[model samples]
Target: MDETTYKFLMGASAFVIAILGLMLAGTTILPEVGLEKLRKARSILIPSYFVLALLSLVCCLTGYDRRIEPASTLLVASFQALLFTMSMLVFIRPNEVRWKTVFRQAGVITVAGLVLFVSFFRFTDYYSCFFYSGVVAYVLQLIIYTRKFMLAYRKTVQEVEDYYDDDEENRLVWVKCGFFSALAVGIMALSILFFPVLYKYFVPLYVVFYSFMVMWFVNYYRRMKFAIPVIAAMPQEADVCAIPETVLAKTDGVAAEEAVAVAEEAVAVKEEKSGAEHLLKERLQKYIDEKEYCRKDVPSGIVADSFGMSKAFFRQYMKDSYGMDFRPWRKELRLREASRLFAGHPEYTIEEVSEMVGYNNSSNFNRDFKRMMGMTPKCFCKQFQ
Candidate 1:
């Protein structure tokens, strides 16, 4: 690419990147339950892009088109580090983002990256060595980030599975796609530094890719904000699934009340508690026996309401009694019923059996079945035959 053409494209890239920053700015109101950190991350991100645009314009004007200057090197390294760190903050331990620690870590890393960046700069003959070494370090950094992000992604998937029965919408798959796409873009961006022949192609591609990333993030955040309530109302201490009558009978009465009053109060409390527990248990058993879980995807809130229990309390109850979360428990029930259906109705297609077992998507049904049963639906059917 010629000097004039490269400069024009770089200028356009800067403008597009700045516009993308503004697009990110518009999503500032997307923070929802358990995701306050995303707002802070976005706050850092918007300014970072503006800084990127300024750097781009500066490099373009100075004819440091190949990015050989120390200033350009430092700025690019800092931007890449910021991107990686912010991504780690969002995905790894989202709620526990400590700005002080993050700043400190960034400071330490910046010093180290500067040292590596200038290792061969003083020796003009070894500039090639310096450039390739920097690329090696960038590749290593990406490898580390990818591994950590993948581990975090797996944990996030487990949490999503545990919390939502359907889980189709809440899986954070877009975030994973964005993360890997950023790494892929980073590789392409690095190539532009090595081979100026590719700069013209890459600069425009980077602008389009980043704009898509910003939009994807905004859409995902908006969906998350709507899917999860802003505040989960925790159940009060008095609110419980099944309070034991024995515990209620031992509570002290008011100072003015005599022993007889205390006894009478305890007896009334025990009767009320017992009656409520009996009714709820009967309803719960009926819910189970009638195979209500097989009808459709049921959220914990609905299940809790049917038992006249709070959502939080019901989740805890499931954890305590069943040693698993509601989704997994419900999944087991549906899968077992599916197995039975598969054995009895050899004529049923995998999709038909999946729908009968409350799985709206056959793909999810296949995935879950393979995960649980150690084989595909087709393979399982073959065993039955």
Candidate 2:
């Protein structure tokens, strides 16, 4: 492509990137993530990214193009900021290890600062050194991101070794795919730097590559929009799931007291019974005791099917015997098992427990956990520790 075409392409790509940034900025209220540090991290990163995209677009549109020093600085700096911002995001995901994440963020930032400082000194001899340095820095960032992703992948496999959510596992697989795709584009852009003689010819290529990165970023943003709430809610759900009897015994309000009384009566009937209700309870209890309901997708039909019964029959039987339907009954089973797991393994995180109990999304787990448990997972764990 000619210089005119390349300039237009860069400008157009920048505009698209700015729009993506705006879309990302549109969802600022993350009721999922409870940590102030994470909240601050996202609040800063999104606005900063949006600002950088806008600035780059402005630079591209102005007479001061990529060949010029000022525009080049703005564009390259924007790319570097994008890389570093994403790295920090990985550090802020709902993980059990905060110190490690903090250390990684500090290390990446320190290294980035040093690289930028050194590249600036070399900038006088070679203007493209600024972008060349950006490519390398992004490579380093992808390395950090990939490492963190690998750790998360391992956690998904090792912690919940037996149970796996196909959809959840599929999403985890995409984590690597997204990072690798960006890294591959980064490498393609970086390799062009070696052939500085034809770098202008490749400038359009850079625009395409940069656009690819932004597109991947949009995908990440979309994923997080849903994932954050689940991640935020995991702990509360697990802890509340841990102590069912204790949770059920408390009556903070009239409605809660009635609910607790109903649960108690149900329990009392189970203890003092030998009829259809007791028989049904025995069959379901035995199945639940065997850790069968740990998968979050355990529908009543599926469970009943396993026991050679129809979904309708099971649902009616559960309602008649315990004044409840399948959903609450299954939740009670999960909570009891999760509580058992928490009491036995105090070190187990909400993430781990949520996974074990079949919650693929931590945000949903956390929300449900709080709604039912009345306390966060971390708070519940602390009571024991």
C-alpha lDDT (0 to 100) for residue 201 of candidate 1: 79
Ten residues in sequence with the least summed lDDT for candidate 1:
226-235
Query: lDDT tens digits, residues 1-385, model 1?
Result: 5878867877888888998998888875543555666667777778878987887787678664444643354337545655654644474347445677668866765665665556546666766665566567666766776776777667655544444556553345666776766777677766666566877777776677678757755765554442343122222355444443343343454364565676776788778766765665687679778888887646667787878876665666678767987788888888989999999988999999998988867888999999999999899998778
Clashing pairs in 1: none
Off by over 4 Å in 2: 28-30, 33-41, 58-92, 96-141, 157-168, 195-281, 284-385
- Model 1: runs farther than 4 Å from truth? 64-78, 88-93, 112-133, 165-170, 226-281, 285-362, 366-385
* Residue-by-residue lDDT tens digits, candidate 2, 201-280: 44455445445444444455454443444444453322121112334454466586688777887686555433544556
Provide the global lDDT of candidate 1 against the true structure: 0.67
Q: Alpha-carbon error at 56 in model 2, in Å?
A: 2.4
lDDT of each: 0.67, 0.56
